[model samples]
Target: MLLLSACGGSSGNAGGSGGSSDDVLSLALENTLPGWDWRKQISAGHVGLEWRPVYDTLLRTRTDGTVVPNAAEKYSYNEDKTVLTLKMRAGMKFTDGAPVDARAAKFSLEGFRDGGGADSLRLAGVKVHVVDDLTLTLTLPAPNPALISYLGGSCGQLVSPASLDSPTLATKPIGSGPYVLNTRATVTGSKFVFNRNPDYWNPDDFPYDKVEFLVMADETAQLNALSTGQIDGAEISLGSIERAKSTGLRVDSFPNVWSGLFFLDRAGTKIPALGDVRVRKAINMVFDRSAIAEGIWNGNGVANSQTYGPISPAFQKDLVDHYPYDIKAAQRLMKEAGYADGFSITLPEVDHYNDEYSAIAVQQLAKLNIRAEVVSVPRQESISRILGGEFPMFVYKMPVNPEAEQVSNVLGPKGAFNPYHSEDPELNKLLAKWTVADGDQAAKVYQEINRFLVEKAWFAPFGNPDLPWAFNGSTTISGTLGTTPPLYAFK
Candidate 1:
């Protein structure tokens, strides 16, 4: 899920090669939150650590956006384009050594579908079919070109039967992934010790002996520890990139699949300002995304033009380019919408997005004669309020997905994330066509969708930012060419 799959086709035999248990590795991260359950919601911060030794999937996209096989050894598409048959590798076992057969994969797929959670919408139209122990097929209600791509998303990560052995796999998970969870309790808010699986299917290439994840909120605290050698690497805040570089540490910045915005509550009736489409467009034009990307972000980020989509090639074509910065256009739209004198709206800020970005957004809105009230709150409280439809327009972050299906799930009018209730009939028609086209044809359709979103000013894209970091001298960092994906494999 971290941009690409590091997995390869099976060489021959499957299972562990008997490595020493002393080879434990440790990693450090800046923040943490309560949603560790992969089945519940979409949170990138959790997936960075939680994904390592916990979940497995059928295919993975590398930093270059190339798909690679993970759990499935061989796969084939049917003539009708409705069934996806995958042949599982033999001799593979879970952490508990329970047989990771086709049935287990089928159960994981079916469990997610019937879970009836927000994530269920991603799998709603698909049906799982078990052909045999080594082979399984995914049957879609219609011809879905995004099926294989969906298999590479966070939602497609395979879960083990042992994960269900306990009632709370959210915190204490048991998986067959490359790493295994070694800690049982939270240090600050869920800390884990990740040891390279001796039984991991591919042990030769996974260089890290062990990995550790500490979930703390303060980015400055993370940087402070990295300076003192308490942590090796951390995500630097937008304002701290140059300072991190000044310390002679290695800085890695990439365009992450994360975007922040003020989501208007479409279901709410009280806030009349949000009902107007021009108001949203005005909001998009107000913020100088380029300035935010250059000054505050230290050239580490990009201005995102489209709100509810991924930055990857899989979904990028469906995204509209840059948002118009002309304040006159914004003013015209506002006046035509009958808010010529400007109006005030309150926005509750969620901490997951950059705080500076939210404050700047409020200032930008003021330029368009629109007053925005900023209310800072904890991440969980903000999410609860937003989900309950309390705020008219509130700050939120949408994590990037490398697949197009994830986009459909978030942006499609009737899809799960219909928060704005964007009922663009043309977009709906294109999405339907996109869901069933071949890879090449899908890309073309997405290109049209992208142009449409841009023309409508659906969501502004701030440029992708660089993610800075410092690592041990032994670490080797390389960037894949002509792509904006974020994935790294330690050698």
Candidate 2:
């Protein structure tokens, strides 16, 4: 299974709306909403799909990833790009009658920054200030072009200042978006119902009068729902592509995520063999990415050696398959690293990932005399076990976001994925250059970093898997880079 990180929630019946198909836009999500708390919600995967309709972001991104104004009509940056100013649309009010002003914007931004959301780190060291009723400013510690992109996502979602401190905020949302959550009709973990906001400033933008999301974890059930007209759209796996196409549903396929092994023990504190660059390169050469992409992803993806995806500015065409499958070459490297007799390593078996990939990887490593052990852990405990340094390596899937966001989340010294906090002076220097550079200079620096990561064998990337979304004839959805498009994109 191609697993995206999601929070587990209770399961319940998917109650029907009993309304005409034209009036109600129904969709199936692979998981339920973690909660209504904007501060706790993840900005990617299915979670964003759930709550975005009820919240208006300060900025929105086009399908091509360009930042455009949404709730905030205008925005600007300082000369050094360290200060961002936002001008909110006048007379906007939340569902509960609270004005969506600069104070509310500052409150929401500060709440998210301090609330420990999955993407909260994006707002770290940033300060929000209210310039006036219609304007606000964000002061950054350093120049970060990616901050605008983050605003286009959950980090930019605004909440009512009146409800921000309410205990019921976790279950009820108060925002100025085009939709209002129908809590009476919603069943926790099963179905979510939304009613059209009569007072919304941009009513024509959202065509549906009523929106419903059914949580269907199983792909087969999702396919059944789509075919039977129970839902208008859903995200399906690669294996279900043919079945979905046969049913006349439009299958939108695009490369959005990358899956493979994350080598977290580059410093070799826990796993000595993994510390050596030669052994890491040897491990990268052992896997035939072409076969894995075809076999595991059903030929829906292309073999990739670098972490950067095609949509990213840092993506280099020549770096797609930097390492070819060559057992002899891998053996030579192992010998050079003084690991001719492979060592033992333990990998975490999280519920989110399909064990088949790990099994195949273990079998392949056995050829080099490496003894690998898999320890099964619950999904809730997986992050703590993996990031807490309990496991040196693990197979996982991650989003291919913009170059700067990717660097901060995965490659930077204090990145969330960098558990051991491994620091490379050369990599740090490149990061500083990329942060201050812009236009062609920024792209060049990012590409250089991508090449450096591949040459160093920072990760054993399998490939970029194609994400397929099936929509009925009545619904039209556009694809976005790195993530599923926001709920408003559905028409």
Candidate 3:
């Protein structure tokens, strides 16, 4: 991929497009954004650009794990959590100066549902109804347990009703966000320059007068820009933390993603050894999760070997030690399962995680007589190999979403990644309980389901890697501080 030449003057020690003022904040992202269309933008690279500055969600999630209203000033739901009613703030307007009212609210929410995007799954069976200028109601065919959380996410964001029909809005967005795109100053697909939205309802929230987003596919390039002052901030990997802080950049880190092996052939469809539960347990018992998390991930990840991160709402500390590294015990189990000499399996080559983790697993599993073969292929081809069920094990990073409906699709019966597309009657029942239940009720149900996965050895979760973010200086952007810029507060 070709990179755009940096605009403005020398990479000075200041900020802004030309390094002239702090009002203009420039940041670097690891990948180029797909586009400005929220319904179509699924990558995390474009989240911050969409969530806080370019668009506004009906609800917003804070760093402290609270979900509150943003564009929708207040909201309510029925007892079963089926019907949702949203009451908008008195005076919000799109960048085009169009009033953001109930009709526009319905249009935006329904737009996402029918947009054929990744998020449409969240809005399944959702129907939007406009009640009045400031009120809109969302009806669901059944209880949507994760409705509030989704409403607080990218899928629930509202675009400008004025520009909803414009084909250009896909490449160029117009929302009631804190910033407005300055097309003349932007080099589409490379860098986007946004001036503070003067007509924005919440202009006082984002302190910066200007903001610039640069798309650099190279991590080293992002850090280089951060070092030379070409950009004020860059989201980097754990490998770059010490190097970045050494250069006097402020590093802000958090837990963002979980990594692990998905045993796709649990029923022994492709790998007969996996049909036996002992084989799977033996695999889990073979990992020194702590060492791998500390050494390979560089202390940037937690050692909890479960799909759910320690910070996740569904996490149960008692289950954190579900798997212990005991090579002798693992070997014994393998022998009992008739794989004493070990078995070989193919894993897709995922450059980011698979290559390194699989290499480490090979060295460890060798003690148990397990032979591992990792094949390198294009990213999509590797994904197809797993989705097509041509492989036994898959290595990748997946979000530990607390939503039962969402989590179930990946780990439940008919789960996309479940080994052999397996199903546990009791576990499925618990997942059903979790979906309709919240708070302590839901947590209890999820606890049972999580424990079952561990006891059954359904997954070998490697835990969430700590994410690192380094910024040159601080501005008034206050709220969640990770990759996704949810809500901002002006100084």
Candidate 4:
């Protein structure tokens, strides 16, 4: 659950410290935003999430986990769970004064359905029907109980019809959000200023008037800037949590619903060492999750074996005790796998977690007779290379929905996560049950799948680190932070 700080009122406005008449709020991050075009890419760094301030979804999720209407004033469902109707607020317009009527909503959704160059493959199957100037209908091919959660996702955000028609709008998005993009600067560093949208639709709900984002790709530079007060807040680095807290800055951290690999092994790969399931389990047994959580994250991480959490009532808690660090048992397994001689394996650069943490893994795994070769690369190139099958083992952080159906996106056919080529008829069978089963059955099925992943040694489930952030004592931003922080409420 999210713990809202009853700290005094935000410095001033939703944009920055309230007392300051200057509407320009400066923010800083540790990396350059991948792109400004929300509809053109997925995982475009924090800025794309920042775009939530520019784009509006049909519904909004509050820090309390309640859903509220945003662009749409109301939405209803039919008895059969096939048709969903959304009603938009009348007289709404984008920042450029372009009417954000039902027609524009229809066009934007249709464009996404027809591949609007946006990275929205999850919504590829949705069929939309505009009922009238005030109502929009979504007709699903089959009954989907989790559709509401999907609608509340970042990819479901609405775009302007004029922007959809104009190809150059990617460079300058015109949104119905509370803040409008002011200047997009990219010289020595990347920066953008957001001015208050005076004609914003929800004045009572949105509090801030302006906000600024500065991209600082270098970790050292981001830390320096935060200490010098050049920026208000930043995502906490692994080794800097204690330092941040000691400075009187608020350090907020929580266990995210995310999982990463300590190691991965694909069957029939060149590295015969990884082909042995016992060897993989041996490595998992030797992994020191507690040390990583304490030494690296400064006690701001959660020890997890699999991905699901209590947030999803369906999460299986039995799996929590599946793996524990036992060097003796690991060595026994290593000997049983005919690797008493210890073989060499490449520990490629993983871009998902703190680079220093991955380095720590390489050092720790060496004690158990598994000789590791470490290689580092840029984050983008590293992701592309790993997904393209460049290395045998790698690490990645996956942001997943808290539902069994959406969880299939990773383990399903052609899914990005089946990197080890793990396939089972029974596993596929359970995924198909998502359409017909309710929460109880879905939980059982996902539990079965979790057991399968563990037994097969498909991937070692390590700790799910709590996402930590350090904000200036004077500035405040609203949103619940998890694996992937919801950015819609970030004013």
Candidate 5:
């Protein structure tokens, strides 16, 4: 899951040709580029939008969430599925003229694994070997079924080996991608400019000759830019849907993220109530998901209890209402858990997200006799604070990735969202089985995992919220499996 942050910046008319020009594509991003280091890159949310055009991954994920070949022509796994060998496409070179060969792939992969990035754990206990100039193999300690899919995301983005040790690597990017960063025209926090790579290996993939990202942290500014023909498209809040449509802009909405409260301290190291399954289930049943979704999201989201979206293989329609809104039942559970008097807990909030969710949570949880305190934290420090185990539970949003990736992010023993490192023996067993399972067996295991999480009340997921994007009709933008559409997906 990407820890989103908000920062104020001025939106300018830099490279804003609107959607009238077919050669240039302009869009507004909620956040500026965090950095250019692909190793520390996040492949969801607005951050992914900033660096996607400048780096090419070994594999690619289609709009339908299928993994396919990109820089690598083909890939195969060993009989035991512990080793993955990739064959690189011939003649591909980075913008700096370094050959994008097996050695470069090895360096990039190893660097990412040891870089301590957010997604580094995906490659933990993995070793890379260069077989030749065009062939490389990744040896894994155990079979990871999601490894291929991860390669299509940030974890697989390849950087030039020549620039690996460059001091300016964080601020500047050097890769074999569709576009090159126009450093002269880019204003660090305001706007970013990219020009087509003349020597790009796959020129036909990207139709636009130039791509520009204007930093518009405020949604109102993004809407104004879209209405004034200053930008082609922008990811907007659900509340702006009607306003955007009234202005004659095309609105594209899809389920991309699930937002709700994360019960991080299941072990109850700080709050003993969270350790009891009954207390967690009682908390889950107290909130009306339908009311929250319609009232807060303006009827733009679906009310579901599971973290997996409709498209995920693990998504079970029957689990949508696993815990219905029943105040009496919740109180009964709370009383049964010997917490009839309730307990106090603090929830951290960020400015970028709507405060209404947490406010409603506090109100609903109060009915169940739980005193929830909402604490506002700085956007920059919110993620660190949560991961540091400062809060037992908190309201947040996260992208709905594939089943395997979702498990690795939220349910795994070392999951990013599992800040307290809470462990369940049964969940650990299912996760181990999922790593080596394939085909029908894999789907079954995934569903079992989802059922286990929901039944155990590990989280109180409100629903899968629609990610809305407003744009002009000059060019078409396709929906992606991420918060924002990729630049190459626009035509």
Candidate 6:
């Protein structure tokens, strides 16, 4: 995802409403808003486009990878960076007339940390304190470089304290955002309507008078809606790419997700052969990454040496060539590790695409004397199996965060997705240093962690998925997807 500017993409020259009239954009969301409280969720399924109109966050992250105060006007931190302070603008009132003060913000943030489902991880060790009407402080157990980024992400969106008191808050929320959910035009579970907030703080920034969110999980249905002018924007499936273009709808494409093979036996506790670094390196060297990327995904994605996005600064082009496919080298490594006859390994796959990945892997590993057998497991049991060390290797999709903290968590021993149960003490110490480091120090630590993971063959990286977001030609979008956690602006 792009660490985008507040102004997303350049505006289209296509003559349309130019955001006059109601400027009510009917956007299709992948899932229904299970609840209205931002604490429960701030997005449909973490894309966060649908959550913008109803709430705002403390900070807004920019394309230049810097953060500017949004609802917050000023901020400070202690010498050690464990305690952070933020000053909110005075007189910022919610649509329901409650003051958007430090106390209220504290309550809102606490609600999120206590019950934010998946997002609870973002504020794990942080404690919130109301200093005064304008001042709020966040105390962290450890230094966090991405705290500001997290506050500007989906987890950062805040709701009004008054909204939480409402019995119908799960369906209707009162917020300080630029729009109010209009029940008159809304249909439960199918469609939602948001009328403009008359007393919104930054009225000039919000061009639209109304915005509508619809649960449109079907790509074909979203396409039909776009043609009929029923919706203005929707997330499109890969199969709908051509149809969306044929309809003249503008498509915004970004790095979707990283799908690759993960090594779970770095310690070789379950798989003794994998304890040898040569054996692990051999596994990474066996696959022709270029062929796997180009042949399997076609133009949908580009071959990536590491799991990080291509645009990320952490990506080291210099080291990408280290693991180029060489059958002779792979065989040598295996034989050096006393596996000249190859070894039998079981790989678990949940999805149909991964099943195909298994097939290709089996064909390649056979040549190197490694017999790879794939076992199909139900998708629901995949995570448990991974955590339980049921498989030595598995095909998986890793979400992109574009932040050091995310990678830190994933590569660390305490990470929720650390399926490998990786417990390298040096790695842990490096991560601890990375966690506290700032700017140049942080960058240096991150690069080391990123490089270490790749060099150790922790993951056999593949390519980025090309996720295309379809929008009607009538709307001129100025903001990019996956930018600010709240909402993209209308150009």
Each candidate's TM vs. the true structure? Answer: 0.82, 0.89, 0.82, 0.81, 0.92, 0.79
lDDT score of residue 116 within candidate 5: 79
Give the TM-score ranking, best first.
Answer: 5, 2, 1, 3, 4, 6
Per-residue C-alpha lDDT of model 3 across residues 1-491, encoded as one tens digit per residue: 11121112212132345323566677775445557777754423234444357777787655444566777878888777778888888888887778888888888887877876544656767899888899988998766565776676666677877666888976678777767778888896688787777776555556567777787757788878777778877666777789998988888766756777777777787778888899889888888888878887898888876777776666788777888989889889998988898778776775433466777777777887878877786532443356557777767766565345346446654443452567667776776677677678877777677778778987787777876677766532343323344435222
Per-model C-alpha lDDT, please?
Answer: 0.59, 0.79, 0.68, 0.61, 0.81, 0.69
Q: What is the lDDT of residue 480 in candidate 4?
A: 47
Q: Candidate 1: worst 10 consecutive residues by lDDT?
A: 13-22
Candidate 3 or 4, higher TM-score?
Answer: 3
Please write out the lDDT profile of model 5 over residues 207-285, one tens digit for every residue: 7778889987778888888888888888877888899999999998878678887898898888999999999999889
Winner by lDDT: 5
Greater TM-score among 3 and 5 belongs to: 5
Q: Stretches of candidate 6 above 4 Å error?
A: 1-22, 42-47, 163-165, 238-240, 255-257, 262-283, 326-401, 412-423, 474-486
Off by over 4 Å in 3: 1-20, 43-52, 161-164, 263-276, 331-358, 361-393, 400-423, 475-491
lDDT of 1 by residue, 409-454 (tens): 5566535555455566777788778766666786677667767655
Q: Candidate 4 on 371-447: residue-level lDDT in tens?
A: 77777776544544564556676555554344433454456554333455556676666666765565467567666
Better of 2 and 3 by lDDT: 2
Candidate 5: where are CA atoms >4 Å away? Answer: 1-19, 352-354, 377-388
Residue range 1-491, candidate 2, lDDT tens digits: 01111122222223335323666788887667668888876565677778888988888765565677878888888888889999998989999999999999998899888988667778888999988999999999887767887887778888998776678887889988878999999999899999888887777667777889898777788888887788888877777788899988889886867888889989999889998989988888888899988887888988999877787888899999788899999999999999999999887775434454788879878777788888887644555466567778778777776556667767766665686888788898888898788778988998999898899998888888887889866677666445566676676
